[model samples]
Target: MSSAYPTAIPDPAEESAPTTRCRILAVAERSFREIGYQKTTVADIAKTLKMSPANVYRFFESKKAINEAVVERVTGEIEALIAGIADAPGRTAEARLREAVAALHRDTTGRWAGYPRIHEMIEAAMGESWEVCRQHVDRIGAVFERIVRDGVRTGEFEAADPAVAARCIQAAITRHTHPLLVSQTHPELEPSLVELVDFLLRSLRPAREPARG
Candidate 1:
């Protein structure tokens, strides 16, 4: 529902260089949120900023560039959240992994409900092989890999290749984390998030011993 400017868009300050780009990105994000990206024009963003469309172009070459920047910003937020969950201290890797998966589901579903256009843009970016989209996937994959690595260190999971496990987990959760895939699900036809996470956790757990007589 709120603006989703790229994390690289630096914080604004008095007479700072990043301030102009920051301002432009802020207005453009808001405009996209208000009017879907497909319907929003660079001129619309310029007028909202009280500037000319030509000036908007000075910072961004075209609408496609602006859209990619916005996508990067949104996925940047998601990537940061994934990193935060992976780094959360004092929790077993299982707890951290569950939280990580849940966080992505919540973010993707929330945005899909409130800012459908952003979700649509992300889907298109994926289809088109956008660089930002690749970066987003790589960053998210890294977080999953971190959690898997931690699990192995803690003896909670038995995996020779954390990278493979990480990729598997990421792919397994696509229905919950991908907007387009999620859109196809029927609430009545699917398991709850808790159930799905429980299944994934089982895969990560070490084989249990038989109970002693």
Candidate 2:
């Protein structure tokens, strides 16, 4: 299998300021993937980029800042993917919601199953960079809200408040989607992903009309 880390860290000396910043993050993400973020020092990233630690500091004030930037990039990619599924053409709202949740499960397992140490970076972000984490959560919830509102408008779903229902759905699926839980839990021990999504979808369906006497 191809290594997830880059083959070569870019030489940031000849790069522009923004390019240098992006390169530093690239190297730092690789280092974090190889070794846990706690063990990845600013000096290590600097050495990889063939730049002085002081130069790395010019772009990021400290290790925490670098971790925040990396987390933002990773979470941003995830948000973009989920957003795409939410707005996909020619799909019903129900289909979009099901696919979006499935995508989250697949993403969590596929991305972190190979690199267990990834949890360390995520945990660090949660503990130290909560604002970054919160923004990601909020963005994801917004996507869910959009799909729920679409469903309600089409009479495919019944929700008094789409925003609240969207959050409920997000909370309900946390076990299937959370990295720590997905990594640690035995697959056979939990409800299947399809079953869970089906159950949530049932809850959102509009109530049936009263039967004739």
Candidate 3:
């Protein structure tokens, strides 16, 4: 018996740019979020924006181009948050980490909730946009790495691989971002931004010897 093979898809990144690229990108992001990346088409965006499909092509050659722009926009917000966290003033490395995590969650869930569909698209795009997603992840990890290294250097945290420690810290912080997780585990424990920072600080503290009897 013969088996059928999947067809190879075209890469959207290879297309040429158009004169009204910015306008097309803006409309594309809005449309994609309102409907969804899969359901959205160049024609749909063009119709919503009162433009011809051909005109949309004059801006973005294909739907993939718009998707790339959407991903970039979301990633840009995350990068900005990471940058702000790195620059924030804190008494210790752990304090900085906590503040950074809280800030990231608030910004991501509060201001950018519309991008959840875009995020889902990026994950589904796997082969098409995996590199873009990876780059953003690396950028976030770098911020955490810097905080971890600073903590270790100042005796604020125990010695460990900064890169690995950064990943762990990021994972812990991300887990609290789920609405279900926060609601179920911390419903009554509404932590102020500073309180969240304190929790991270305590977690990063070095172990102490048992008290003598």
Candidate 4:
């Protein structure tokens, strides 16, 4: 599937650049949150880091690069959480799927309410040819695909194509995960989270035998 955002750029930072990049991203995230991204500049981020603009530029080329790094940071956090849930011990696939979807919803909502400015950055990112957003989508989709394949292997789900099922599941929950959609969604107006999971699980269940007279 074509992506709505751009791909991530490979960075080969020197030994100290990693630490410096992290510092720059941290300050840029806060500035974006408190002051908004369009208002934040390379000079502002550098000043917050107590470094010269040239120093910050050494780690990040420009203002756009800094914002992309911050957005990628957010996507990386989501990927980590989804990976952890996918590999959680001793849970049925159904249970794990439910938990993963719930976590996605909560994280999306949290971004909108807790860090509206960061959420705004996400919205802007998705609307453009941002590779980080594309990579984010692919990474998270892979987690769902893995969980669905597990379900099929364990006889918890019956599917001709686990990848297709995974896509459908994510498509079903887009309202809960997409930054722009989540902000406009009212929780009460939608089916309860558990109810949604139950319906999706039913779609994966094996067909029941017909009763005969």
Locate the minimum summed-lDDT window of 10 residues in model 4.
1-10
Off by over 4 Å in 3: 1-19, 89-91, 111-122, 125-127, 177-203, 209-213
User: Which of 2 and 4 is ahead in lDDT?
Assistant: 2
Task: For model 4, state the Cα shift of residue 199 in Å.
Answer: 1.5
Instruction: Output the better candidate (2/3) by lDDT.
Output: 2
Best by lDDT: 2
Q: Compute the lDDT for candidate 3.
A: 0.66
Question: C-alpha displacement of 195 in model 1, angstroms?
Answer: 0.5
- Give per-residue CA lDDT, model 1, range 1-213, as digits (tens): 124334565455323435566788788777766676678888888888898898788788887787777778789999999899899889988888899998999898876655656655665566654788888888899999998999898898878799999999998888898866654557798888888777777777787843222
lDDT of each: 0.78, 0.87, 0.66, 0.80
TM-score of 3: 0.71
lDDT of 3 by residue, 36-102 (tens): 7788888888887787899777656678777876677777887787777776775677667776787
The regions of model 4 sitting more than 4 angstroms off are 1-16, 114-116, 127-129, 209-213
Candidates' TM-scores?
0.83, 0.87, 0.71, 0.84
Encode model 2's per-residue lDDT on 100-193: one tens digit a residue.
Answer: 9999889878777677688888888899999999999999999999999999998988999999999999999999887667776666877788
Tell me how far candidate 1 lies from the true structure as C-alpha RMSD in angstroms.
5.7
Clashes (backbone N, CA, C under 3 Å), per candidate, total: 1, 0, 0, 5
Residue 78 in candidate 2, Cα distance off native in Å:
1.1
After superposition, the stretches of candidate 1 with alpha carbons farther than 4 Å from their true spots are 1-17, 127-129, 182-185, 210-213
